[model samples]
Target: MTVHEDVGAFSPDSEWPQDATEWLMLLREEPDDAEIRARFEVWRSASPDHPRDWEEITHTMGVLRRVTPVVEVPVGRQVRRRSVIQRIGLGRGRVGLAAFSLAASVVLLAFLGPDIALRLRADSVTGRQEVRTIVLVDGSQIVLAPQSAIASRFENGRREVRLLKGEALFTVRHDAAHPFTVFARGLTVTDVGTVFDVDAQDAGRVTVAVREGQVSLGGIVSEHSPILLGAGEELSARDGTTETRTVASTEVGTWAQGKLVVHDWSVSAVVARLSPYAPGPIMVYGKTLAAECVTGIYTLTDPQGALRTLADGQNARVVHATPWLTILHR
Candidate 1:
């Protein structure tokens, strides 16, 4: 394999990794052949994009492995396009392997299909560094925080919003006949014409903070009683346990204003909140450092800068392993 010195600057239309699917197909067809493996290694090393393309292909394969039962395709039967499609249950539609270029189709179906489904189902979704306000057919409004998704339905004499992921602030449109509700993390938040924020916390936990009017929080299980909250009140529920306390309205859902306000929160917890706004993964190494309490209002506009500030305040060191990976250590 002739290594190109200007491989990184290679044209996107180049033939190197553009033929990645063929390479993958070849590897699948002859996995035990040392000669083919050696040539693949040479081709992969010939350009920077080659490994990236291969990583994407492998990632798609991993997704396919998880969704489907069959793991390994037999070397002899790998080239049998119909068998592969039947195994993955893609034979139902007209989308057979014959309809598309083999490797490209596999990658697209495995990777982009799920995302397209999610986007189609979601009424509103926000990416990192984006705060979006969406108005429903009714007079109700939602302020979706970064990396959040919500599906809204205003049918059958009911107003409902499902928080599929992340946090959202809902300002309900008061209608006596239509009750407004938000379902998140296996909990239900029913509004009494209120402006409130619901956070879908990790480990099936949820936090509901009411800024105005009133709202009720209840678990999906019938045994769990509903907790009614008024203005300046907040409720945190997890694992059949619930905690309620008074909170300042100013502190609820302040991320919409490019600010993150936390009071006596652990470093790990704060990092979890900031992860949605950060460009990539933010990790904390030391248990003690992660456990340490932090209280401050950090700007969300510059997540990396805010992280460095947090590290300085906690007497920790910030390490950038890559442009997308940040680690905080004591």
Candidate 2:
């Protein structure tokens, strides 16, 4: 099943070789074909462009196979080969060879279409303290925050995403067979089609917040207690205990826009939130100091300033345990 054989599948009058599918089938069943191997060399030498297109077809097939399970060959609506020997219709008089060449080109293009689409659709990485907004081919929007990395692959079975680090906000487009899933650390967040936020913390914690739809969060998250959260709801996991809490966080996604608003929270909790953005370590001197409650809006633009403000306003002192470490005490 070579590109020459499948001319009709891609374009009815295209002279493209239908050999791509055959090579794919052969590679899957019996990859070490001596004849195919020999033919590959000769084919490459035939024309510099021929080998390039051949590689493109093969690459396209591989991507398609990984993303979609079913591979089909169409018989009736076929692509016809064009005049291969014809140089921009120069060899039109030598019709047969030109037609064969044209057909090969069309079939090759068809096979390569899927691969090109995949490349255009995939989203890769977001570095430290940075943000990336991706518009997927399916029209979904994904905003990945700093230090986050995400990879997406869409196949017949599902649309999968692996989050290597940090956080992401997914505004998914609806596709049941291609359900969107974000994998991070030991957790997996699966969504049909919704807007949600996923955070992968360094301390073996994963948090999922649903802004406009529903999501099933599992793994180191809730574990056996897989929870579904809707708009304005969030779930957090730590040590093995999972907690689901509701907040009046109408602006739950302010961090994506460079603002982090913390409501009534303990000093320890506030310190924990500030740690990631802080230039140095932040520690509360004693258990009582750490447990002290903090209520204010801290600007993330200048985290060190916020620390100084905390010390001055709370009648607390900032102690330098070490150059890289600092603790707060009364």
Candidate 3:
């Protein structure tokens, strides 16, 4: 049941918690309203608890927004377009104090989760469809994929980057004295004067694809001996086991060129990669469709179009639940 439904009674609309919820929901519903925004600022600064209540609600909603529910499209198929906030049923205009307090306690914990720690330490971060390139002090270039983040540590004559989330393509400047290294999900890829892509995906799966030169790969790093992958090589690690494959050098980092290249990868994997470009979550449902493996190149120029094409190929359909969320159903 929704928090709104659980609260059998509500206080007057004057409470700070209720007012804060109403203001935030209204602003989100009509973000272009200047008058509403101006009034909101006044309300926020009215009292210390006003902004305090606002911040608490904002952080709760922030984490809730990312809690994508990839469940089966609701039965009866009465699909409707709604943002995550609306779907979760946070009281829109009349949230009771008790109701909001209940929801906030649960979601606030998630707001302070590991993602917050990553955000604190990250040197670079990219939002949806926002790819960024960072140049280190040593002249190496790091191209961050959409929804990606990284933290670089260059102290003690050691050049290393911790891939905090998503993926990044690194073009290292040759420095024999200090070898460049990338760490993601317990896997390590030490550069051998090369360009390589490290994709850190869900379930502790890390894929490292070398394009230009060579890289030494180690799984869980501390236990396994490091292996080498020269040009046109890729390695995927799952459960501490590694698989080496041959991928076209030109296919690496193709998302920067408006294309995504994969070989014998699952449809779910494709959705995961394309999701960074999509503003909201792109859910893939149905066992058969989710398990379907695909090959060949796909377009990233239009993530929605690419999703539709991928769903079509896998005998699934893309449903536009809202501007923020897309569902692929079989």
- The TM-score values for the models, in the order shown, are 0.63, 0.52, 0.64
Predicted structure 3: clash tally: 0
Q: Considering every candidate listed, which one attains the maximal TM-score?
A: 3
Question: Global CA lDDT of candidate 2, please?
Answer: 0.58
Per candidate, the number of residue pairs that clash is 0, 46, 0
Model 1 lDDT tens row, 93-144: 1222322222232332332322667688888877765778998888898998
lDDT of every model, 2 decimals: 0.69, 0.58, 0.69
lDDT of 2 by residue, 1-330 (tens): 664343223332423222332223323332354544544444445556655555755665455345535323332211111222122123211223222222232333323322434334436654333467888777788887654567777766667787766777888988886778888776778895678888774467777778777888877765697678888888877778777888544556666766666766777777765554554446564456567777777755666677777777677665432233344655
Question: With candidate 1 superimposed using the best TM-score fit, by how many Å does residue 126's alpha carbon deviate from the native?
Answer: 2.2
- Stretches off by above 4 angstroms in model 1 are 1-121, 221-225
**Clashing residue pairs, backbone N/CA/C < 3 A, model 3:** none
Comparison by lDDT, 1 against 2, better one: 1
List, residue by residue over 190-238, the lDDT tens digit for candidate 3.
Answer: 8889998998857678889888999988758446678899889988888
Ranking by TM-score: 3, 1, 2
How accurate locally is residue 113 in candidate 1, as Cα lDDT from 0 to 100?
24
Q: Indicate the TM-score of model 2.
A: 0.52
